[model samples]
Target: MAQESSSVLARPFSALTLQQAWRKTNENPEITKADVALERSPRQEADIFVGNLIDERHGGPITIGYGRYARGQSLTEAMAVDDVMIVLEERLSVSTEAGTVSAGPGEIVYMPKGETVTIRSHEEGAFTAYVTYPPERPAHL
Candidate 1:
């Protein structure tokens, strides 16, 4: 038998723009790169930036962040948590086990844990999005 945990009721919440979140994250020195797990392509670390918005400190079960990728920059990693990504600007190519899909401004994508995803900005101008995910689940689960 499994132990039960109390379920919290969901409520309405407020949100901030990508730029606003980015500014807030930068203002806090405690939110370091280690807190924002990003796997960039070789030699492209400087081309990608992630600004965390909501994390454990926010008292929420999920973390949200803003990611910006310079043209020609790419990042690849297996999803450690369920993630929802909403493209706010430019174009992004998301490659997964199913196939590669292209999303432009106003598009949203969902990826599940353990799914390998490669996000690339292939055109002029930077690609931006709001990404949200829950805390990584234990491997034994």
Candidate 2:
């Protein structure tokens, strides 16, 4: 049997305001890796870079992570929890089982639990987004 792919769920908020906030706080913003349970191969190039703002390990039920996708890179998966994503810079193309949508700077996108989605960045530049989702415990644990 083929293994199912892991997805990210997210709802986007205003990108402009968030970008401004990031600029103002860029000097020393707290960032960490997202704590989602997924398998990734070391040989695979890291197309997505994530910095966590809040997570379960930090004593929070909601997980908030900032992500940057390199140009031409795409991430596709089915989420295990509800998610929200806010575009911070450039543009991102989001595709779901229902349809595909394009979000630019300051736009927000929402993805429900168990929904399969694909996110990609344009070749002109990298795409940045803030993603948030409820903490989920892996079934194996």
Could you say which candidate leads in lDDT?
Answer: 2
What tens digits encode model 2's per-residue C-alpha lDDT throughout 18-128? 756666546554542233323331223556665555667777877666666777877776767776777767777778755567776666667778787877778754445
Residue 112 CA displacement from its true place in model 1, Å: 0.9
Candidate 1 residue spans exceeding 4 A from truth: 1-46, 136-141
User: Looking at model 1, how many pairs of residues clash?
Assistant: 0
Best by TM-score: 2
Query: Model 2: residues >4 Å from true position, as ranges?
Result: 1-16, 27-46, 136-141
lDDT of 2: 0.59
TM-score of each: 0.62, 0.68
For residues 1-141, what per-residue lDDT tens digits would candidate 1 score against the true structure?
A: 111211111111123554465466567776543455544423345577665546666676776665768788777877777777666677777776556766666555666777777777776645454544674332111
Query: RMSD (Cα, Å) of candidate 1?
Result: 10.7
